[model samples]
Each structure stands twice: as C-alpha cells, then as structure tokens.
Target: MTPKLVAGIEPPYYTAVFTSIRPDAPEGYAETASRMRRSVEEIPGYLGHESARTPGGIGITVAYFRDLESLDAWRLHTAHQEAKAYGREHWYDSYSVHIGRVERSYGHERA
Candidate 1:
C-alpha cells in the first residue's frame, strides 16, 4: 500500500525520516507512537508526515517541519527523547533517523 501522504505540504521544508525494525514484544509501542505524532504537531513549526509499515514490521515515518530549527526542537522535546529511549530499549530491534532539506518538489494528480 502507498504510504499516507501529507496533504497541502510545500517544499523548502525539512523532513525527518525514521526507519525501524520492530521488536517481537512491542508493548506500549502504539501508544507512544501516537503521542509522538501529536506532540510534534503541537510544536511550533511542524508541517505533517507520511508513514507506512511492512508486514515484516519494518516501518518508515517521515515528518515534515518548516525549518531545521523547528526540527531541532522536535528532536530535543522531552517526550520525544523518552520515546527514543523506549524504542532503543524496548520496542525497536533497530532504527535509523535521517534529516534533510527538501530543496524542491513537484507532483501530479489525476482528477
């Protein structure tokens, strides 16, 4: 399936891509994930995101922000820090985070 798209988002933004392999017994994982989404939205410069997971439990979530400073704030958010620790200790078998500037973007849609 296609990952859910972030509607109305424009370029010159920042995107944080998080990729992870799930642990077998991922208790409280869903709850924490939901909270992280909500928390980032409350942050000053959050834009939106697209997320998807494979049947094998490999997942990717790319969240967008207005700038690197906003992205940096989200990274340093206390709750996010806790969630990162939790993923490392309990939920994810492995993970990687990549951040980049969206220099330009173009798309097409069929009506």
Candidate 2:
C-alpha cells in the first residue's frame, strides 16, 4: 500500500512515533504489521497514522490519538502488546518508541 501523510488532525493530541530497523528474514512481519494497523483503527481515540520504510530497512510509523489515555490504551492493547513482543523476538534489529503531545502544527499541500 502507498503511504500518505495523515491530514486534518488538530493539535493538543498525542503521537506515538515508532522507529525501527528490521532484521534480515523478517518472517510474518508484513502480515503482523498489517494486522496491527487494522487493530489500531478499532481503538476509540485513534486519529490516524503515517508510515514509511526506506530501502535500507529503516522504518517509522507515527500514530495519532486524541489524548494520553487513548495512547495508553493502545499501549496496553493485547494484540499490540503481542505484536511488540513478536517484533522484539523475531522481527526488529532495533526499535524505539517516543510519545509526545502536539501543541501546534502547520502544513501545506498543492493540488
């Protein structure tokens, strides 16, 4: 699927920025990732997300939520927690998660 920037999200929201490098032979990674993406959409305060991966295997996914509570919900989600454990054991070479609050934001697009 093509990656697109998430638009129309107002500020005072929270973002979970996940950055990672995949190990060689990441079996079941794509399917698990897709499932996680779908799973996040079902969570109550999910706003949106943007994700991309480079040819060299560096990847980043930024997920937006309406508040810290929503972010925590995602963190404790059973499926998401399982995915995280699987990633650590079999998929990722390295990864980091950074959570931040967006107080303001600005952007532009050409049509």
Candidate 3:
C-alpha cells in the first residue's frame, strides 16, 4: 500500500529520533529494520512505522493511531519496551521521544 501523509489540523503528534549505531550495524540494517517493522505491526494502535540507515545515523519512525489509550498500550508493552532498551544500550548512541496528539486531519483514499 502506498500511504500518503495528508494535511492535518489536529493537535499534532511529535516524534523525535536520534541515533548513532556502530558501523557494523549498517551491515545488518535490513534485519534490524525488518524486526522493528514486524514489532510495530503487532501493536494495537500501531498505524505504521519505518526505519532507515544512513552514513551518519539511523532514521526511526512511528505512526498515528486511534487514541491515546491505544498509544499507551503500545507504550507499556513489555517487548516494545525491551526493544527500546536494546536501542538505548546497544543499537543507538542516543535517542529521544516526543508524544502528542493530532488536532485534525484531511485526506481520503479512493479505491
């Protein structure tokens, strides 16, 4: 599916990602991205997410969900948190997170 980012007037959600993985990681980058992508698909509120590797750093992603409750549930999930910890301790040199809500959204997909 080709997902497009539509304009939104909503509260707006914010996500901050910072990372510095060792050179060896770029070699296994596809595997790591696949793992993270699968993990996201398992979460309840999980709308979508992505990850990318670059010469300088890694790109992380997150997506919009139904509500804060769904978001919170994903947040508290044990495996999710474990993956986060793994990122902090081994995968990433540093990172950050900023959570919020969207105030509005406008767009539609035609099938």
Candidate 4:
C-alpha cells in the first residue's frame, strides 16, 4: 500500500516527517511509541499528527508544530530522547527525519 501524504496545518507551520524501518515485532517498541505519541500531544504548540506503517515494517509519521521552536522542544524532550536512543540501539534498522515549513496548503473534500 502507498503511504499517505499528511494534511498539514496552515502555512507558516512546521512539520517533522519521520520515516523508519524496523524489525519485525520489536519488543517494547509499541508501548514506548504509544507513550511518546501521547506525551507529545501534551506539549505546547503541538498541532497534530498523522502516521502509518507498511506490512513490511516501514513507517512514516508526520508531526506538526506551531514553529521551529516547538518542534525543537519535542526533539529535546527527555523521554523522547530516550526513545530515540532505544530506536538506535534496538528497534529501528534505519530511519530518516525531514523538517519543513509549510508555505501553502490546499485540499479537496467531497461532501
């Protein structure tokens, strides 16, 4: 299946698109990931997010924040930092993070 392009916030917002390849059923990963997601939502300036993963364990998660500073805050969060370390040591085989500022946004929806 194809990955979906996340619908982002209004222009001038920031997004962090994280893509990762993981081992099959990595232990403790699901719990840690769920905790991290919930934790991020409570942070100031968090807008929203979209995430999906393939059957092959390739996944993409796009997290939106009000600005670069908010995004940086998440990146530096202690729990988040620990999760990143765990990903490097045990969960992910490879990963990539792309950050961008949305200049414009338009979409169509059927009623």
- Model 1 regions lying over 4 Å from their true place: 1-4
- Score each candidate by Cα lDDT: 0.86, 0.89, 0.58, 0.89
lDDT of 2 by residue, 1-111 (tens): 644688878888999999999864478987888899899899899999988788888999899999998999999999999999988988888999999999998888877
Off by over 4 Å in 4: 1-8
Candidate 3 lDDT, tens digit per residue, 1-111? 765652442444433233345444544446765776687568665565434556766554545555676677767877667777766666666566667566655676666
Query: Using alpha carbons, what is the TM-score of model 4?
Result: 0.89
C-alpha TM-score for every candidate:
0.89, 0.93, 0.61, 0.89
- How many backbone collisions does model 1 have? 0
Candidate 4: tens digits of C-alpha lDDT, residues 1-109:
7545546457789989999999767899889989998999888999988887998999999898999989999999999999999889998889999999988878865
Top-down TM-score ranking: 2, 1, 4, 3
Q: Could you arrange the candidates by lDDT from highest to lowest?
A: 2, 4, 1, 3
Which lDDT value does model 3 have at 9?
Answer: 26
Better of 2 and 4 by TM-score: 2
Residue ranges of candidate 3 with Cα displaced over 4 Å: 1-32, 50-53, 106-111
Clashes of 4: 0
